[model samples]
Target: MENNTFPLYFNLTMFLNLGSFRYPTFVLCFLLYVFIVSANAVIIMVITREKNLHEPMYLFIVCLCLNSIYGSTGFFTRFLRDLLSDSHLISRWACFTQVYVIYTYASYELTILGIMAYDRYVAVCQPLHYHSRISLRVVYRLVALAVIYPAFSVFTCVYLSARLPLCGNEIPKVFCANWPIVKLSCVPTGLNNLVGMLVSTTTVFLPLLFVLYTYLRIVLVCRKKSSEYKSRVIQSCLPHIVTFVNYSITVFCDVSLSRINVEELNPFLGVILSLEFVVIPPILNPLVYGLKLPKIRKVVFKMLSCLKRCH
Candidate 1:
């Protein structure tokens, strides 16, 4: 296709065959979206409202839950709409907008996780200096870094993909993504690929490595401590570890699906993998934190009891 003849809308080809299953799938997805939003929102609300819970750790959890809501809203709102509609077409501007929201959401996830790891590290390895090190001013700076860095990096990526002269517009998956759009380019995408690799390394792998390193130090610190002390440390760290590992696996599934030949795979499996990163983490983060952390759990239970009494 000529540069000037670029299509105004892209067909999200993945949704074309839902047929009779569409309504059921739409209902399931709609419910899932609602739960994700409500769960994350409760986490945010609980953390923010309770003064005792307003530590560096809980504040980070609030950031995480807020990001979950932002990311899920970006995807699930449009997704639920798409599920019920006969047409799967998305305008070029809207497609790029989704690309920005989703990509930034992902980037924010890793960055926030990285900061959370740092927070845990200070709290565990240097307890005496935890407050001094992770002071209110420092927390603000870390949060700012987490938010700003991702926005800038993902924006560059989306800009690169958006500027490409596309030869096609049938995005194979359920949602708009940078790689699929880049793949549609009629011309060479060496620069885009190069920058993407650099961004991925900085935003994804570097944070992952940092988390690993922080945990390693925490482990070494635990070696000299009493059983009770070790158990306490484990209790605090377990939720972050679980959240990190779960998110990493989901991200891997989505990234691998994007790069691989999906034609050989089952269509249902393809959709599942595509939706994994967006769906699983948002729901899981709240559950893991709410159930695992004693303080948060107590607050949550207390809130439930009050609600019951009110009812």
Candidate 2:
């Protein structure tokens, strides 16, 4: 009860009753966190160092990788800390911070994917205007919008949730998420739920809709083009589509798991669902790009050859 003196901290009840399994879970998650960080970091480093990769597509890929790192850090570090500690409580401020970072990262990923879709649309549809339209300056603004728009919306939701009086302190999930936090409110959460829905639609799905539209047009154009043109589109656009599909499915699972009763679900299933977003996308994006994008793949191969020669 002494801990009650700090009303701002909330108990994370997801790991309760794990007993001996927590140790192995901790080790598995720690290694995964390391892999996610290192993999994303390598992609970012490769993008930055390769002068030829300064174009819009590669730059957008850089933003995606950066978002993965940002989002993963927000979750994994706290998860690791809680794994080692007997207590799994987070200060309200830290919870809100995680909510902001993780949600913003998700929104940013969608926005960047949309931008990349548009970039490809222009590149394939209006090849002559591609250089003029998606210039370096334009890429800068797209990246800024991806970051700023999500931050503003998420900040609004978090700010609203923070002002609410909480009736509960035990969050059922492993890490802090906005929906779980909203469910803890003592007062009427109609306003919070409304704002949450509004922000979720505006920041996440609207961009997704835009991506769908752009890709539709892209598909139409590809239908009329030569085999070589189609090949080019497949080469360039497939990675984005793969990344988007993988992220969408994992996010759906995460949201579904959070809304349902954790008591009914198996603990292992719950853990996997909770970690789907943090684990899958961060590790998957780099692999998709590294293997799919020719320029990046070429650079990776050249580096591997150089290392081989050195040995």
Candidate 3:
């Protein structure tokens, strides 16, 4: 961290270690996190309350909303603590908590995306087989995978990767992330680094690759399909394309962290990098799909009217 601030809610027994100018930026980021939370919350409600949206696609979307809400909130909570504090010192436990949360939710989000991509693949590539292959039981199981796999994956990574003891905590990144946490520990974190990075690749790339391949195949089919289904397929696939692009960039940023020194990273670049992962995709995916698909928009309007009347 460029400047110093106390980890919010510090009990005054720990050393604080940030530089001077980081707090204000953290504050601004905090505000943006608040907006993200609010926006995603409304997205979840809209998807859930609107009866017409109770389909597999929208169900996956609602799952995305929940994942984004979880991931972003975990990150911003730590950011909030730092933003409110005047020093950069964070306790070992606090740092671990942040890392665990952010990693778990991120892993969860990636898993969800993979499941969604599979859903789309079935819908588009195997239309006749889609209903049989992707029954309610299967969607429910996919949802379960999205929810449960993160716990298993994150726990495995946290357990297997972080065995070293922390000597002095000068955590490199402003926020606590797995690689950064490994770097902070004085004990040789080389193995941890390698394993952690690999885990990250698995968390990120597996779903990402599936999504890419799924979409690519979908695009091919779209070209061959009747013009009637083309528009809807194109509209649906665009959102996933946008979402995948965002994920690719974010995974790039994270993987790059292992190779670069955080101190040398540019400040403005840092803010944008952090924001890009959650803020960009959730906002863009909904906008791209909801706006392009007239049916979702129409349903949204009807739902809004119903809400208005209820109020």
Candidate 4:
């Protein structure tokens, strides 16, 4: 009965008109989840089956798609179930698990993007050294760090929240997130907040800065090149810039919406805003890369033509 007594579950209070819109929302989300998984799977399969695409860049794209699947699975499955259910409560362990997966996915994405930028930088600015510099051993190490560092940082945040004495059980969003759970603690969360800020800086901002720096260096190098060389840079780097910008905006919106007071705002709009990063980026990343990368695009078209012939 005490405020510090930890309950085994907490009710999510963030769905908008759940009873009225349950069926429609569930069907739509189910379809979207299916599409996201399928699209990412097709890209992963194409990359794996094509031996020519077995380079570092394609490997990182595969990792990105894998992360998209990993992250979306954390949110959409439980989300679809809750849409049709009367009770929208999640267990303590489940909430923490979701928190870990979602945040780790976010962190890994930035790391991958940063690595991609570095890959582009090497290919464009130091063409002679690109292959020698970005060896398989180097790529594997970076990939491991991308996966491990985020999980470690998120684990610390979640572990700290787990140790806290919780005084509330209501989450104001459709899914479990690190900050919202921390807000439920009855005790002072200064240390948790501090650790969280540190993690965000190291994981998100640092990687973003690295990406920007790599692009800037690439631009400076491009200024001295011929028109054909400049065009080559644009063809390869443009998609990355677009992907980075798109992801940055959606993620910023997601993080900002989470921290601000939105109880007075339209609940439907708020829910939609929260879901943007999850829904948009997974679908967008693969499509953008598949359409923009010439080699990948040609392979995709060839595969489609073959499928058409068989049918």
Tens-place lDDT per residue, model 1, 36-86, is: 999998988999999999999999999999999999999988898998888
Which model, 3 or 4, shows the larger TM-score?
4
For model 1, where is the 10-residue window of minimal lDDT?
1-10
Clash tally for model 4: 0
**Candidate 3 at 295: error in angstroms?**
3.6
Each prediction's total of clashing residue pairs, residues at least 3 apart in sequence or on different chains, is 0, 0, 15, 0
Off by over 4 Å in 2: 1-6, 16-18
TM-score for each candidate, following the candidate numbering: 0.97, 0.94, 0.82, 0.96
Best by lDDT: 1
Worst 10 residues of 2 by lDDT: 1-10
- Runs off by more than 4 Å, candidate 3: 1-31, 190-194, 303-311
lDDT of 3 by residue, 60-158 (tens): 878877777777777677666765676756665676677778777777778877888898888888889988888878889988977786677677667
Q: TM-score of model 3 relative to the true fold?
A: 0.82
Q: Which portions of model 1 miss their true places by more than 4 Å?
A: 1-5
For residue 196, model 3's alpha carbon misses the true position, in angstroms, by 2.2
lDDT of each: 0.91, 0.85, 0.68, 0.89
How well is each residue in 214-259 modelled by candidate 2, as lDDT tens digits? 8899899899889998998899989999998898888889879878
lDDT, candidate 4, at 97:
90
Against the true structure, what is every candidate's RMSD? Answer: 1.2, 2.1, 5.2, 1.4
